[model samples]
Target: MMSNSKEIYESITTKTIVAEINLSCNDEQIDSISLTSEDLQNTIRIEAESSNSTNESYCSNIIEESEYKPDVPTEFVPVVNSVFKSLNLAVKMYNDYAEMSDYKVKKFFELHNHPLESIEERPYTKKARKMSYFEKEFVVHASKAKMGPTMAHKIRAVLKGGYEYVRVKVTDYKNLRRGVNIILCYKDAQIMINKMNDRRDHYPNYSFEFLRDGDMLAVMFWADEREKAFYAEFREVISFDVTFRTNKYKMVFVLFTTVDHHKKSVTVGAGLLSRETTESYEWLINAFLSAHKGKAPKVILTDQDPTIKQAVESVLPNSRHRLCMWHIMRKLQANVTDDLLKNKDFKKRFNKLVWNMHIKPDEFEKKWELIINEFNLEDKRWFNDMFELHDKWIHAYFSDTRMSALMKTTSRSESMNSFFNTYSQFGNLLLHFMMNYDTSIQKQRNTQKELDHLTKKAIYKFISPRPIEKTCCKSLYKYIVL
Candidate 1:
């Protein structure tokens, strides 16, 4: 039998919907939305045959397997155990579905809207009544008699120790509503509340905040949002090449910046903080991986500080860590004779030749060797000083793509150091801010950090003084964000 083209086309025109739904069986739920052409092929054939009363070939399944995904376009994931509240589930079923699969049974009462007919292998079991008090509330694990603790409970207890306290019940008796409130005296309540803050005596209550912390803490708070989704939107990379002053050589801070950002120290407490070790580099990495995951950077420009190198290796080993040529050039500039510094012509030519090292390593070396020969550099000890680890400092790997677009410089880190300079200049610790005595203060609190940066930049420029050039460094620039 044959059918007209228009009739055949009409049969295949309706939209095909693929959705993922939860399938609960005997206290278990599995989400899978993989409907292959074969699975729907029979249905398609039956509908077509009923409509056409004629055989026809349809080619809608011609798309590649690469395009197959049964989830809603923006649904992100097919299913989450978070969707159902009554299904406390082996609560442990979360740890490993396999364990839940092995241990699940049709215990006593069928808990949810869908019921399990038999005590078969599955994840969660129905809850039974014999309420008990949790630390924060009065509650009970469903089927406490047979089910025991859920997987979530087992994992939670193993990770976080259990503590108990009295709670005041806030109840609306008429509405069958009650809430448990922790009972704490002023002292205990204040102490816990203080700890909740970053232990800062003062903080500007914010309209918005970007909190960077460990995965464990992140997951606990934003469990529904992203467990390990701390990613950085970086435009540049700057390095703070300094060791901590902590008694134990702890990682106090990792000074960093982006071209489109500001220079700031990543200080997430030292020794046994939210993490285990105090190794400055290790903790530095903890901050980076915590902040920037998956979006591997192109390069990281740093100084030749061993501690910093260790931190970079642990956190972003793949990122190219190049020595800030500006810093290196300045270091040598100080050793350079006044005759060299004063002679603008010589300095200009010398500076031009040195910068070439970043772009064309071979050409820079060839030109440098020629310049040395042209100017008796061996006699002056200039050639001897530039050769050690020269490529490691100036090559493409360490070259910041973001910063290079600006004139190459470590001005960002220098700017941050300038900010730290005000405290550094005082050298003496202040017992308090004395906010009540603003008349005694020379500058506004808002201006203090900026003043420090300006002063430091002035001092660095006085010392390094090639010129004031913008850097492509991302984070450092963010500090002065408009």
Candidate 2:
């Protein structure tokens, strides 16, 4: 009976191995293969017997087991004759079945090979960096408020709790601002022109003129209603001067400034020109006159630029053009010898002669001639040229002109330029420049209004009991009550 059972078990095992190989061979074409209860019983019996077999017999059983293929493939396969089952065969079989069933296997990685960023540092990463609508609006408003990008970012960081919560770097803010400026630059000229037109339409006294060079803005001049009124009231002593490069295009900023009733620097009109040529200056002067109803100032003070002199001569021939005494005096050191400048006696006398408001032109000439003779500077070209143009700069020559004493220099214009520099930037687009200009002008007007209020409300005790003093205090501005 035992011999018969062994023969039966061996025969069953051999049959099971043969069936498994045959099933695997047909696995590519079959949908699936199922085993009967008898086959499962036979497999269990074979595994039990293999556990009790001798070492050599177990090794032989393992060899046979490795050679036997399963009906369905698995990820782990036994080696056959030192060669493992081909993964491509299993993959191809899976692919064919997947194609027939319209199915796909998608791979996903849940673990990363590299170290991950901490939560605090994640916001600064490129993937996490972004500007929201509110953040962008804040940045734009900050820019309009004259805040720089880094400052704006800092403010935003504070508002958002911290820099980590801001979700963007300072460079991102700068890049966004730069991009916005670039977009604005494309429409700057047209937008400025449109704004001017709109202002002109709304305010009848608001005036603006522009010259174009091949569709590009070359020159622009503008004066609001308040500025026009300022020009009308304080038009006697105008100081015109060009500021250093104040815009992106490297255009010259020509400001027409004057002293108001409060003796504060007032910008009556302003212009931007591509070039500082005579023609450009003439156009600007003409525009200024046109903006103010062609009411030329009685006396205009400016630095001694030949182009400006020619422009004034051609445009405002009736108006007296006086060179700025301050500018000429500033040039004294450069034009004169150190020996004469070092002479305290010569410096005192020269300054006294040049600044003497009460001196007659003949006396000024005689004193100047004596100084030149004493300094042995008769051969100095700058001195000779300045002497020849003495009538334009010397206080004695043009002092008789009405309101000429109000402005002996272009200092008002210089102050106005410095004031505007606070509001405007060299990299501003034309539209931004105009906006900053409007902001500055509005500030100036506000200050003027404040002064006007003070003049009207404030009372001063009479320092001297004189009718003229009382009358002047009541009539003139408080600042002019000297």
User: Which candidate comes out best when scored by TM-score?
Assistant: 2
Quote the positional error of residue 432 for candidate 2 in Å.
1.6
lDDT tens per residue, model 1, 47-70:
444444443334333221133343
lDDT of 2 by residue, 26-48 (tens): 32333222222233334435544
Give the clash total for candidate 1.
38
State the local distance difference test value for candidate 1. 0.38
TM-score per candidate, in order? 0.36, 0.70
**Candidate 2 worst ten-residue window by lDDT:** 107-116
lDDT of each: 0.38, 0.74
Scored against the true structure, residue 78 in model 1 reaches a CA lDDT of 23
